[model samples]
Target: MTLLDVTGLTVTGRHLIVDGVDLAVSAGETVGLVGESGSGKSLTARAVAGLLPKGLTATGSVTLSGLELLGARERVLRSVRGARVALLMQDPFAMLNPLCTAGVHIAESLPRSPRPPSPFPPTDPGASPFGTVPADPGASPALPQGSGAAPTRWTRATRRAEVLRRLAEVGIDDPSVADRYPFQLSGGMRQRVALAAALARDPELLIADEPTTALDATTQHEILMLLRNVQRARGMGVLLITHDLRVAFELCDRVAVMYAGRLVESGPGFDMAKVPAHPYTAGLLAALPSATVTLSRLEGIPGGVPAAGDVTGTCAFAARCGQADSECTQERPPLREIAPDRHTACLYEVRPRPRAEPRAVTPREASADETLLRIEGLRKRYGGHVALGGVSLRVGRGESVGVVGESGSGKTTLARCVLGLVTPDEGRIELAGLDLTRRARGGGQAHRLVQCVFQDPTTSLNPSLTVGSTLAEAAAQGTPEGRLSVAELLDLVGLPASYAARRPRALSGGQRQRVAIARALAVRPALLICDEPVASLDVSVQAHVLELLRTIGRELGTSLLFITHDLAVVRQITDRTVVLFRGDVVEEGETARILDAPAHDYTRRLLASVPPTP
Candidate 1:
C-alpha cells in the first residue's frame, strides 16, 4: 500500500522551484532522495507535508494514506502532522529546546487524555492506516480501584514510562538520559533523543533529511543502523534525503536522484550503484573518495546545480555533463522507463564504463634537513581537562600529512596551537628553526610562515568584505616578492577573476570555500593548516577542494598539515597519517600502511566505521 503519493507537485515563490515532481513511498519501504544542495530534495519532502515556507506555495496532489493534503485546512494538516507523519531535520541540537529535558520533549508528543475527540475518524476499530496509538497500561497503583469513573490511559506515570520506552527504542538504554538537557548530551546522544521524540507519536511515515551529516563516522554509522532497525521493527515507511550516495545505497531499498528541482532518475539502490542509468548518478559515485583505495584525482562533476528556473527547454545538467551535446541542449528530456524497475531523464543511453584502475603512487618522504615545522612535547591543559598530551609531529617542505581522529581527540587543539590561536601549557614549536612557541606568546613574526583554512568558510570569511578586499589584507602581511594579486589568487583556485568583487554571501558554499583558500594562499605561507575544511561540503565540491589543495602542494611546494575525521580523504590526499585518540597519538605511519593494516585498536575502529564503497 502506498503510504505517500505526490504527483505533479510544484512549489513556487517568485519562480518555480520544484517542478512537476512525482514521488511515492510504500508501506514498510525505505526510499532515498539523493541530490546536491539547492537541488530541491528538502523542499520536495516539505511539500509532501504542506510545510512550505512562508512565501512559497505548493500546488497539485499530495496524499497521505488516501487523504489529499495539498490546499488542506491548517487544522486538517495539524491533525496529521505528528500522528501520521514526522520529520527529522539535519541539526538535532537546533531542533531540540535547550530548556526542555529529553523526557519533556518526548512527552509533549504523546497523546493527551480527557481531550475533545479528533475531527478525523479512525481508519479501523483496533488500528488506523496512518498510525494507531498503542494501548496504554492501566492507571498507576495510587489511583483508587473502587471508583466508578474510568481509569485515564494517559496518566503522568504512563507518559513517563512511554518516554523511557521510546528512548530505549532508539538505542538510548540509560534511564538517566531522560533528565538531561540538550547541552549536556553529545552530538550522537542529541540525535538519538531527537529520533526518540520523532517516534513518540508513532507516525507511519518518517522523513529524515541529512540526519547524520554533521556526525562523526562511527556515530553516523550507528545512527543509520539504528534508523534501519527501528524502521524494520515498526514496519514504517521512510523518505531519507541526503547528498551521500554511499549512505543512500547502504540504507535505502529504492533511490531517486534529483537535480535542478527535478527527478532525474529512480531505481533499485543496488542496481543503480552497480549500473547507473543517469549521468548525474554516475558522477556522484565517481566523486566519492574510496575508503580502501587511493586515487590521484577524483572525477568531480564540473559546474554547479543550476538555480531554480534557470534551465528552460533543455536538460538542466547539460552544462556539467561530459557527454552532453547539442541535442541535449535543444529540449528537456522527460523521465522515462529505461530498464526493469529503472527510469532515467537522459536523452542518450548511459553505458556502464569501467572504473579507473588503482595505481600505486609512492608516498612522499620528508628528510630531516627539509623539515619546515616541528613540534616537541606539545601539551595543553584546560581546567581539569587535557586537550593534548605530549603530541609531537613534523611537517617537511612540500609534504602533506593527515591528522585523523574523532571529535574531542585534540586534533583542533593541536591545529590551534600551531596557528597561535591557543597557547600551549608546555611545548617547543619550531618553524624554519625559529622558536614558534615564543613567537606565539610574544606576538612575533611567525604568522608569515604558516596559514590556516577552517572547517566553516561562512564563519571564517568576513561577510562584509569582498573577496578582493579579504585577499588584499592577507597579501599586505606577506613577503613582498612572493605575494599574489587578488585576481591571480582567484584564478589559482579555479574561480573567475571577476569573483573578487563578490562577497561571501553572494557565492555558493563551494565558491565561498574557494575564496577562503584563495585568501589563505595570498600570503604565500610555507605551511598550511587545514582543520576539517571540507567536512560540510558536498562530495563533488569536496573533491574539487581536495584536488586544489593537492595541486598547491605539488606546484607551489607548500607543506600541508591536514586535520579531519574522514580517513577516506586522508588516503586520497595525504602522504603520512597520524591517529589521535583522547589527546594522545595512538598511531603514526605511512597512509597506505595505516589504512591497509592499522596497528592501533582505535585506528582499526575508525577504519571499520567508514561506510563501504558502492
Candidate 2:
C-alpha cells in the first residue's frame, strides 16, 4: 500500500521554488530523494508533512495512507505529526532541546493515556506488549481470586521502561545515557537519541533528511543499518533525503533524482546506478570521487543551479547541461516513462557512458631536505582524554598530504595545534626551520607562514562583509609582493570578477567556498591547513573544490595538510596518507599503497565502511 502519495506538489513563496513534483513511498519501502542544496528536495518533504516555513504556500495533493494532508487543518496536522509521521533533520542538535535530558526528550514524544502500538512487535506471545520481557522476572504470581487492584492503562514505571527500551532499540545500550544532556553526547550518540525519540510515537512514515551527513563513515554506516533494520522490522515507510548518491544507493530501494525544483528522474537504485536516463543524473555520478578508481580530474558540472524564477519556459538545467542545445532551451520536457518502471524528464535518451580506465597517479616524493612543515612527537590532552599522542608527520613544499580519521581521532586537534589555536601538551612543530611551537607560545610570526580553510564557509566567512572586503582584509596582512587585487583573487579561484561585489549570502555553496579559497590564497602562506573543507558540499561542488585545491598546490607551490574522513577524497587529492585512530597514527604511507593495500586493521575498517561506488 502507498504510505505517502504526493501529486502535483507545488510550493510557492516569492516565486515557484518547488514546481510540479510527484512522488510516492510504499509501506516498508525506502525511497531516496537525491539532489544538491537548494534543489527543493527538503521543501518537498516538508510540504508532504505540512511543515513548510511561513510565507511558503503548498498547493497539491498530499495523501498519507489515503488521508489528504496538504490542506488539512492545523489540529489535524498536529495529530498526524509524531503520532503517524516523524521527521529527522540533518542536525539532531537542532531538533533536540538543550535543557532537556535524553530521557525527557523521548518521554515527551510518547502519547499519554491510550498508548500507540509499539514500534517493534513482540516475537514471543508471552512477552510484554511493549516488545520486551516482563520487567520483573522474579515477581510473585498474581492472586488466584480477583487481584486487589488491576494495573492502570498507563503508568510512570511503564513510560520509563518504554523510554529506555526505545533507546536500546536504537543501539544505545547504556541506560545512563538517558539522563545525559544533548551536549554531553557524541555526534553519533546524539543522533541515536534523536532516532529513539522519532520512533517513540510509533510513526508509520519517517522522513529522514540527511541524518548522517555530519557523521564519520563508520557511524554513518551504523546509522544506515539501524534505520534499515527498524524499517524492516516495523514495516515503516522511509523518505530519505540526501545529496550523496552512494549513500542513496546503499539503502534505498527506489531512487528519485531532483534538479532545480523538479523530479528529473526516478527508477530502481540498481538500474539508475548502472544506466542513468537523465543527463543531470549522469553528471552527478561522474563527478563523484571513487575510493577504488583513480581519476586525473573530476568532470564537475560547469555552472551552478539556476535560481528560482530564472528559468521560465525552458528546462532549468539546460544552462549547465553539456548536452543541451537550442531545443532544450526552448522547451521544458515533462517527466515521462522512458522504460519499464523508469522515468526521465530529458528530451533525448542518455545511456551509460563507457567506464574509463583508472589513471595511475605518480606520487610526488618529498626529499628530506625539502620538507616545509614537520611535526615531532605531537601530543594533546584534555583532562584525562588524549586527543593526539606522539603523532608525527611531514609535508613537503607544494605537496598535498592527507590526514584521514574518524571524529575525535585527533585530525582537527592536530590542525588546531599547527594553526596556533591550541597549545599542545608536548610536541615540536617546525615550519621552514622556524620553531612554530615556540612561535605559538611567544605570539610570533607563524600567521604569515601558514593559513587555513575551514569546513563550513558560511561560518568561516563573515556574512556582513562582501567578497571583496573579506579578500582585501586578508591581502592587507600578507607580504607586499603576495597581495593581489580583489578581482584578481576572484579570478584565480575561477569565480567571475563580478562576484567581488556580492556577499557570502548572495553566493551559492560552491561560490562561497570559492570565495573562502580566494581569501586563503590572499595571504600567500607557505603551508595551508584545510579541515574537512568540502565535507558539506554536493558532489559536483566538492569535486570543483578538490580540483581547485590541487591546482593551487601545483601552480602556487604551497604545501597542503588536508584533513578529512572521506577516503575517496584522499585518494584523489593527496600524495601521502596518514590514518589516525584514537589519537594515534595507525598507518602512514603513499596514498596509493595505503588505499590499495592498507596495513593497519583500523585503516582496513575505514576503507570497508565507505559505501561502494554506485
The TM-score obtained by model 2 is: 0.94
Itemize residue pairs with steric clashes in candidate 1.
none
Q: Which stretches of candidate 2 lie over 4 Å from their true place?
A: 114-154, 351-357, 439-444
Model 1, total clashes: 0
Tens digit per residue, CA lDDT, model 1, 325-365: 99998888999998887999998887554455676968777
lDDT of all predictions: 0.85, 0.86
lDDT of 2: 0.86
User: How do the residues 1-614 of candidate 2 rate in per-residue lDDT, one tens digit apiece?
Assistant: 99999999999999888888999999999999998898999999999889999999999899998999999999999999999999999999999999999999998987764343443543231321223323221121211123334234556676666777777667676789999999999898899899989987789999999999999998888788878877876789999999999999999999999988889999999999988999899989988899987787777888888755677578888888777889998877889998887999889878554444578888778899999999999999999999999999999988999999998899999999998888899989998878878543434357878899999999999999999899999899887877788998998899988888899999999899889988988978899899999999999999899989989899999899999999999988899999999999999989999999999999998998899987
Question: Which candidate leads in TM-score?
Answer: 2
- Per-prediction TM-score to the true structure, in the order listed: 0.92, 0.94
Q: Locate the minimum summed-lDDT window of 10 residues in model 1.
A: 114-123
